[model samples]
Target: MEERARTEEEEMTLEEAFVRLDGMVERLETRGIPLEESFQIYKEGMELLKKCNDKIDTVEKKMLQVNKSGEYSEF
Candidate 1:
């Protein structure tokens, strides 16, 4: 059988992840929600934080490993 299309949640991109993280921070700062809801928001924020940080770390690591003496390197 053919594979089904994945929804936005399943296909979240790095940009979308950052957007969510920003919104989470805004809500936490606003302090309009109840304590229980804030806790849930905090949990999700942490997960997003990890994901964003992981993505950045991965990119940085890849850049560091790139040989500066390779053909693409300047003289």
Candidate 2:
């Protein structure tokens, strides 16, 4: 199941994942959601969070590569 989630996440841009995560947050915050459904949303949110972090990491690595001095600098 995680493998499938990762594959799907790979196809999703970070902005899209952020939008999905925001929706999940709104759903979780609303009244009347069942406990089970809330748990599912939480799980999906975590997965999206991980994907966003992975995407950010990839971008940071590329930024570092572009810098010839091999030192981290504020973008």
Candidate 3:
């Protein structure tokens, strides 16, 4: 069966996104896709990048320690 492009709202793990982005890069480097499809793939890769960044930011925030006084700050 053919695989369809994933929508931004679709749930995907960071590793999965990275794999997809890598595939997109390889396809772009090979340079056989039409201009429109290339643009679409590029856009999807960008969205995946943003998702990865957001996940990292969330992990960073979670790593912060909270003091006994209820005050908290990121390390």
Candidate 4:
């Protein structure tokens, strides 16, 4: 069988990722969890945060492209 890669949508959109991360924060702040579980939640939240940041950076680059000069020049 051929191997397959996961799609970005299959993983999680930046919005979805942020929502989950926010949930993690609420859980940590208001609802206490076992130390072990807290670490896992924090780790997962960090990973999601990276994905959201990456998406934001991609959007910023595209915006810069749209705000180009006379013509689209290589950066």
Candidate 5:
């Protein structure tokens, strides 16, 4: 199930993931959602968090890959 969701997330941009995650947070905080739906949102939020972290890690790795001249380079 998670693998399937991850596959879907691959098609989403980092910004998209952040937007969706933020919306989910707002919904969870301000609305009275059902227990089951809340759990579903929680699962989706976890996936988004993982996706965002992975994106940040990838960017950090690329940023760290610098040449001796201090310019970015392929790792």
Candidate 6:
């Protein structure tokens, strides 16, 4: 069950994660948000950030592999 949940999160594209993070930031910046809600948003934003970082790391590794092979191919 946990693995499935992780797979679902990983299925979100990096771009989509960025958009969600941006929206979370906007919500966090808005005035009069309840403290509990703000905390929830912060937690979700952190998760999205982790997802973005994971995607970036994967891409970087792929690029490195391609470079090592001295070949250019679509990622």
Which is the leading candidate under lDDT? 2
Q: Mark the regions of model 3 whose C-alpha exceeds 4 Å error after superposition.
A: 1-10, 65-74
TM-score of 5: 0.71
Against the true structure, candidate 3 reaches a TM-score of: 0.68
lDDT of each: 0.70, 0.85, 0.78, 0.69, 0.83, 0.84
lDDT of 2: 0.85
Alpha-carbon shift of residue 21 in model 4 (angstroms):
1.1
lDDT of 3 by residue, 9-36 (tens): 2467888878888999999887578998
- Residue lDDT tens for model 6, 1-75: 978867867898888788888899999999999999999999978987988898898787677335567877655
| Residue-level lDDT for 71 in candidate 1 | 38
**Candidate 6: residue 47 Cα off by (Å):** 1.0
Backbone clashes counted, model 3: 0
**Model 4, residue 37: displacement in angstroms?**
0.5
For candidate 4, lDDT tens digit of each residue in 1-75?
112222542367777777777889998886658898888888867866777788878777766332345565323
Model 2, position 60: C-alpha lDDT score? 75
Runs off by more than 4 Å, candidate 6: 1-7, 64-75
lDDT of 5 at 64: 50
Off by over 4 Å in 1: 1-11, 64-75
Per residue, candidate 5 scores C-alpha lDDT tens digits across 1-75 of 978867878878888898899999888886668888888899889978888898888877777576889897765
Return the clash pairs for model 6, or none: none
Two-way TM-score contest, 4 vs 6, winner: 6
The candidate, 4 or 5, that scores higher on lDDT is 5
RMSD (Å) of each candidate, 1 decimal: 5.9, 4.1, 4.5, 4.6, 3.1, 4.1
By lDDT, the better pick of 2 and 4 is 2
